[model samples]
Target chain A: MEMTVAEALVECLERENVEVVFGYPGGAVLPLYDALYHSTRIRHVLVRHEQGGVHAADGYARVSGKVGVCIATSGPGATNLVTGIANAYMDSVPLVLFTGQVPTIQIGTDAFQEVDITGITLPITKHNCLLKDPSKLAIVVKNAFHIASTGRPGPVLIDIPKDVAQARISFKYPSTVRLRGYKPTYKGHPAKINEIAKLIGKAKRPIIYAGGGVLASNASEELLKFAEAISAPVTNTFMGLAGFPGDHPLFLGMLGLHGTRYANLAITECDLLIGLGARFDDRVVMNITSFAPHATVVHIDIDPAEIGKVIATNVPLVGDVKLILKELLPLIEKVDRSEWLERIKSLKAQYPLSYNRDSGLKPQFIIEQLWNCTKGDAVIVTDVGQHQMWVAQYYHFKKPRTLVSSGGLGCMGFGLPASVGAALAAHPGCKVVLVTGDGSIQMTIQELATMMEQGLSVKIILFNNSALGMVRQLQQYYCQGRHMATHFQFHPDFEILAKAYGIPAYTFRTEEDVIKGLPEVLESPGPAFVNCIIPPEENVLPMVPIGKGISETIECE
Target chain B: MEKHTLSVLVENSPGVLTRVAGLFARRGFNIDSLAVGRTDRDDVSRMTIVVEGDKPLIEQVTKQLHKLIDVIKISNITEDEYVDRELVMIKVAAEPSQRVEIMHIAGIFRARVVDLGSKTMTFECTGNEGKINAFEESLRPYGIKELVRTGKIAMLRGSKFVALSLAQAREAESA
Candidate 1:
């Protein structure tokens, strides 16, 4: 079957079962867009910016369990996707990005819209290719998908030259990919798994520190079973928010810089620390020497490089978490862990995640109200900052892939566009709520038009602090409160901004207003926005300042 | 820190070298010396990297290198019985009076005079790090004008091999 490379590319996408692609077109991608024009299988979403398109694809991948695909044109269009690509890479989201390139003959001549995108993205991407030969397009696409979605998934880029897209080729999607250098270990070493089982059996106070890898490997159920079999309390990393049931007794909320105090205390005192698909990030292990000092660390991750990269591990299991957990679960011997459970209970009671109830229209209260209104069922997405921490603290997620936020990258402008993708990928009638700060939302507010255009059911919860709350908090602690560029001297009315985008908008100045307006806004049809006026002085508490251990968290006074 | 020599087998593809080099630069892993060339297989290339790190750090470097999609296998051959060699060329000023002494020194090291200019003599030498350093030192008193050296290349002793089958077999046995 002879076809143009662009047409073959579309066929390859169909073969991969890609249902949707978020992209912005440009001159360099004209031929590819023409091919997409004739395709009926894959839906093409035109985002307001290339960054939004990539983020939308990221959200789509996280929610759908598929390799998210995004497309951009040459130079500026490709550059616009850089932040989003880095965001996906840091979070280990499986994404395939296609960028248009100048024609092959003009590649190095500094032709219009020609950039060394492959070189620019080399350090960031897991793998990348610049397509010079049209005959290899199908294989490149196949390889890109395989590399992006496989073990320890990350982003991959395929830059197709304009001429190559226009070139004709015989299309044959390879049934099986054979890369001699790219094999991933999917099963754990039996000896190592046995060692982990023995370690779990011997330990008295064991804690399971779960992260995004658990969710990536679809091991949430196994995580629950492993915890129950070992009777270990599970504390989630920021990315691991929905990996365990938030309502479960063993659940210790999130443990990190702004983690729950009980979770942090449990980490400090636990006898054994079982890290499940979780990298002990700096935020999680604030002081490496003091972090889980008495605990014997057993780090189980698919990526071999991550083991012992930061925190030293006593036993390392390098393989799929779900498979390893299944093997280890059978070997687990449930012990009487009432003493540790009792400690956890007391710690939880003593340092509960609380805020001032007397304060009006608090961001944390809004997240809690949204949780109540949605019944802990909505797919909550959030941008980075105070509101992001608030969502992690307040939203009690009961399901996996329900809380989609930028954990590793902490990209500020991620919420609105990502929610657009999440809403589309979510199950029909499932509400996709975006909790964003005023400063963060404005960074990519243009995506609101994209959301309205798609008629997505995303309820926007904008926490209007009129300042960058996280930075201000940091300044108060670290900069002697010399707040410069932290406060937004001129701020827009988000309600009017949302309304201008044709999204039904409301503003709540009081807690009573939120109590009355939030449920109605969430229950209403199509897309809507609610701007809650929050106090600028509010801060995300229980913060473990840098150089301090998790045990040294400062609780809300 | 101790010096560790690693033999890495990678696919011969565009930007694969960049991928390897970029990884080292970004990860802050210090490379003492590096040399890349074609292997017995046309599609595969071998890179001999001499890096400075402690035991745990070397283990980390090997593991991180293995994460690259193009990197097939890596062997830290520092502990193994291996033969290492580096080729160095020195261009030194040789007056009519110093010719005999320079040639005598070259002959002692088994180095050959590859090129002769009007005011300089270039000697090509191949040896281990000790021999190469000695060769440079002996030529230094002769007013050496320029010098170049190929980074270290090494091979395991006797029947030991750094082949794909051997790596796969080891992995299989461990599994």
Candidate 2:
């Protein structure tokens, strides 16, 4: 059937089973949006801005385990998606970004609203392409999705020229993408799996350092099985929060700069460190010379480039974490590291995650109350800073994909729109929480209108400290308490903003009022927002200063 | 810090050069010299990047380069360099009196005068980097006016084995 490239794009999306997309349309994308106007099977949510659309897609991808889609016009509209695209890249989220371009003939003429988005997003994306031929549109679409969703998944861009979107083509979307040089390794080597098994057998103190790869690959079950089989403790990276059950006895919580003391202590004492789907990023592995000093490393990641990028591994297994663990499952024998568990318990008993309980509307207490109320079942998205760390520390996660926050990029203003996206894709009536700081929430606060328009039941808990909490903490410790532009002196009354967006708004200032009032707000059927005023002087603790090892972490005063 | 000559294979796509150069800039890797040209297949372009860094730095750079999807393969060719060549074009301050001496120097360096003027002569020379450097130094006394060098291009001497063997080994592994 002869059809316009724009119509073919909708058809191609249908072929890939895409149901909903987030986008903001403009001049270059009018043709595609016209086709979307006629399509009944695909639903398009009009976002307030291009960045909000991309982040909404990211949230959808993270919560639904499906590749998220977003569309934007050329030039500034496309450039607006850069931060969100880079956020997805750093966190390894699967997103397919479609941007409109200038017509074929006027590509280099610097046409109006025509930016080279493909060029702009090159390094930050998994792959990107600019379609020159209308007939090849189907193939490029397939390739974009294939590259985005497979093998250390990340964002990919497809720049469609305005003319190509208007051109006619005999549409047939390819069933599979076959690139000669793009075959990802799925099965790990037998030798390394066996070596890891042997190491598991010999080591009395072993720790499994899990990351986002496990959750992205849906290998959490395998991770649980492996940890159980070996009786090893599991500590996750910030991005890896939901990869392992936070309530399990062997769970050591997060391990990094702001990681729990138990997890850091266990890491320093471990004999065999198993890295599954986790890049030993500088944030996770500070002072590499002394990180896991007593451990022989075993790194298993799908990306070969990440294998030796940081720490050298004794056993390098490059493949899907789920598949690798499946092959290595039977080779394992049960271990009883009672003494190691004792040490972990001692550490946990000695240094528990604590906060100023009597302080005005403590953020940690609020998060703990959230965990108590929701049973750690909500899709909790957070913006960066002290509030994000507080959530990671206080909210005990029990399932994968429960925590949807930017990890590597540490992006602010990611919570509100992401929560809307997560709510839309989640199980009907599933709780989606946006726990954000006062500074971070203002970054994309316009998305609240989108949430109201879409009627998404997104619950937001604004940690209203009126400052960039993380930056202030850094300056307090390193810059001799020189507070600069971190202050939001004229911060908005978020409750009033929520009321303007036609949502229920509440204020929780006292620790008593928050604990008493939050559950009612959470249980409300429609969208609700709570402005929780927290102490501005509070900081996230047990922080290992940059370039310092985990053992050097300092606890609270 | 030592020097490393890295051969990078990349898809001949738009903005690939920017991605490569941007990676270096973002990571603060000081590139000594860089040369890029089409490979045997027009679909692929080859970049020879000369960077000054030690072993760990080179490893990190190589790993980071591999993270770029356009990059097909990268090999550090500094260890097994059989042949290296650099092309230079120089405009020398030459009058009728000094033209013979310039011509003699060109002859000694096996260069050709691609362009000529009454008072200045432009000579093109291609040789190993050391020889090119020596030729440029000799021309300095003759008041070299302007100069341009096409960095360096290097390959193994026998059988083009670097590419052939690498491809074959990858094929064997894939098979």
Candidate 3:
């Protein structure tokens, strides 16, 4: 049964039910590629860059609910995966990143194609391993997947030295991982669940603050049941968008900096704020002191550290959100709060989501058009900026786990790669649309080759404002319009770049053009780009300035 | 709100402390004291955190800690029969006239004078939280200048509760 470690790795991947692997071969990973050649069970996707590989895996994971796998060579190749890994880490996507390394003999010698990827990725990954022995390959691979997918899932990297990959060993995928230090609490304690139920029962005006965890744990049903059982309205953070149905009677939409007026007002007025699988990131908690001033916070999450990390919680239920909600639902007393529901209804009516449609080629209008063409089912990935916030504000996502955007890190250049990943993961026939800003798309614009090469059916809708929109907006608000690095005057034409990547490109100058171009782009079978030139002065309205209270939102210019 | 001791096992990595501490700080959770150190495994670290909350909230906190990707295991060893100790190093301005009195007070608390200069002396003391608190209090009257204390570290007292060995824990997780 003796075989090379590289062969063992492929075997382990097979055992884990991994059918697709995105990667590029290089000098350091020759043995792995050689081994991959002999394996027919797994299909290897040769991406143009290491970042594309990681992002493809990210998309594959997000849509399939499986750990995405990607591999790369040493040094620069491994470094290239950093941004993508950080993206997965921020959004809590589960991925297993394998990078080749120089032989152990030349590890510290600064040999060609040698890098300490484990050390370099330590900050960004949930955990990582440097494989020195071929015997540990199966165990490490198994453990990597386990760590990557379990409680508060994130990316994990395993650096296999060239020699280890070539070395001979008997391959046996460990039936179970044995890590004394790692044990995720899947079930919530009965007593704590009772306490949460009691808090829900006692509160007059309760709000369920949902976050990405709800989608990550696949707890939408539990959330719906709990929200209904307690008669509470649900408000979502950016990551929490698809966790609850937007069109539901109790849905208050997104909250915080770019949140809807109704959602923010509900947060301000609620007596009980039950945060499920959502960390109160600063963007969501504009002024921590004034946030939910009257609410008794009940924070439910898998990560214990997140309980009191941002906003204080009276009842901190630590465990899987789905499990905790399941427990709480059964213990709760059912009651109808018609009056509270009516008040929220009134608030929703008074402050419905609206944007000025008079502006030429408005980002909101483009998103609305995109939404119309796709019918709200298309997986929407966005880079960080005004366009990202606008999409979060305007897009009405009907399905759970449909909207794939960076919320935690708000990393720019995330849209293109993440969209590629989402497109790859989408159910056959579903389109993946990336609504990106001109500045954010340029960060990883090299991925254009990935789209062409993979022939992924994704629509790249670029909001070409020729500026770092978010930073520009901040400067306008805080620094008296002394636009420093926020301006991008020399930005390249996205349509031209899309053509360079062998993809059809279109440009929309007017609202009629946007309306015409979107349907054509959405209906296309292959990867395409729509460069919509937008006014740089168009600021994202209903913005809660940094450090300001939710009540202090700027509605219009 | 009663204070409870929580022992958390976390993967050894950068910014893990920040993530953990940031969570508590952001949540407005009152942390009485905290300490962290490497465990038997090179890749894993252990943290001892003391916080004031109800029994339900404390259990929830422990569960939440387990949710952190870096966090491996969380146990509320507060109710368990165990021995807990905290180490505190305090630098006191002990003038020539007060040196003997300071040394005498240190002796009463079983504290060792680890360093001494012409005008100051550093005392090293290790004991349960209460003992360290008392030692610090006793030195406060003598013009304490600086103090540093390692949060409590606890070990079970009986054979029944074997500190789940790394292999056993990993096996359970894999299972």
Candidate 4:
């Protein structure tokens, strides 16, 4: 059937089973929004800001395991999506963003509301398209989703010119995308897999370093089996948090710069480091020469480029982590490494996680309490900064894909919208908990409206310290406590904001109040907000200052 | 430690070179030399990298290269019998007295003097590694101050293999 490019876009989205779209309309996107008005199957949520729209879509994508869709007008609207797009790009979330541009004739004329969004977002997106021809809209839309959701998933942007959206074209959504340049390796070479298995058998003390790919690939079960079979202790990066059960005897807490003492010590002491779906990012490996000092690293990832980028590896397997683990599982023998396990146990006991109980409303304590109440089944999303690191260190996730947070970019204001997405995607009756800081929550506080509009029933626990706690801590350590812009004197009452958004809200100042109020908040029906006022001096511990080795961690004073 | 020719497919985007080179520099991996060019697909480019490392380390390096989002595919093609060539452009200050001698040396290397000014002559040369090295060494004494050399761009001599035709392999898998 002949249809406008804008109408074809909506039809394409419907073909992909997208029920909701998050966006704000403007001059350049008028044609697309006009088409959207006639569509009954797809619901559009108008956001307060373009950033909110992109983040809301990102949240939806993360939770649904589908490409999250967002649309915006040209110029500032497209530029506003940059930060959110970069956030998704860093975290490897699958998002398809649509931005309207001025007509093709006036592209370089700098017409009103015209911006080169594709050029601006080039670095932040996996791939992008600029559709000047109306005929290419359907194919480009289909290709954008395919690129965004496939292999190492990330955001993809499609900029549709205003005139093209108004032009008529025959619509047909392509069932599959065929791009000559983009081919992802999915299966590992059999010989390489066999070599890895042989290395596993020969290694005396092997440590498995799991990353975000474990959860992305849904390889947690296979990872656990491989660890169990080889008697290897598992450690995770921040993005990989919750990929393995923290309570598992063979599992060590997250490792690297801000990782636990036992986890870092284990990586340092192990003779073999088996990396699964984990890139050796600079945050994890402080000194290339010194990281895994005594180990021969066996790196396995779908992306071949990550294998020896940071730390030299002895064995490299390029394929899906789950697939590689499946092949390696049967070839491995189960052996009890009592000595290594004993050393790890002793280390864990000596440096056990601890915090002062004097404060009545401690963020760490509340996170633990929430974990206990939820039994680690609730999907926990966190904002960036001090609270993010604390939640990483304190919260013990017992299941894979339970903890969702910004790891690569450490983007602030990630929790609320992401929580909403998780709630929307949750198995009916599952709860989505958002652990955010006062500063981080305010950055995207407008997402509260999205939660209410969607009726997502997310529980947001805000750690209100009246300061940018992470920056404050950094100032204390590095800047001799100048305190400059870290403190915020005046702030709106979160309860009032929540009420304005038509969601139940509460505030607790004392530890006793938090203990009593947290459970009540979690049990509430629709979207609820709990603002817990924590002490400003609370600092996340076991920090490795930049350029310092993992062993040189500074514990909380 | 053996030298290997690594063929890398990278997205045709800016700063990819910086990312790839920075990765190698940070890891302290010594790269002998490198070459890059546009592939048949405008969106994708090819990079030919030469590095000396152990077999295990080379494998590890290729895997790490794959981790880079800009890098599409990486294959070690050092084992194949291929043709490798480099182009070098050298500008030497010829004192009118040394012009004939410089031309003589250029002729022996099959180099062409692309530009000639009153006091200086620019020679463009293309050859294998040893030939380029010999030409550079002979011109060094003639006041050769500045030189630009394009690193080795290699292709297999026979029509037995082509990386770009992986569509057939993909089709086989789907079938």
Write candidate 4's Cα lDDT for B43-159 as tens digits. 668898999998767876776565455566676877878877899999998989888988999999999999998889999999888999999999998788689999887777788
Q: Give a tens-digit lDDT track for model 1, residues A290-329.
A: 8998999999999999999997899988999999999888
- The TM-score that candidate 1 achieves is 0.98
**Listing candidates in order, what is each one's chain A TM-score?**
0.99, 0.99, 0.97, 0.97
Error of 1 at A120 (Å): 0.7
Please tell me which predicted candidate would have the highest DockQ against the true structure: 1
Q: Indicate whether candidate 1 or candidate 4 has the larger lDDT.
A: 1
Between which residue pairs do clashes occur in model 1? Answer: none
Q: TM-scores for chain B, in order? A: 0.93, 0.90, 0.86, 0.86
Clashing pairs in 2: none
Model 1, A73: alpha-carbon shift in Å? 0.4
How far residue B22's Cα lies from its native spot in candidate 2, in Å, is: 2.4
Worst 10 residues of 3 chain A by lDDT: A176-185
Clashes of each: 0, 0, 20, 13
Q: Each model's TM-score, in the order given?
A: 0.98, 0.94, 0.83, 0.85
Candidate closer to the true structure by lDDT (higher is better), 1 or 3: 1
Query: Comparing 1 and 4 by TM-score, which wins?
Result: 1
Separate DockQ for every predicted complex: 0.44, 0.26, 0.25, 0.16
- Top lDDT hit: 1
Q: Can you write out model 3's per-residue Cα lDDT over B91-162, one digit (the tens) per residue?
A: 998899999998899999999999988889999999998899899999998788899888778877777442
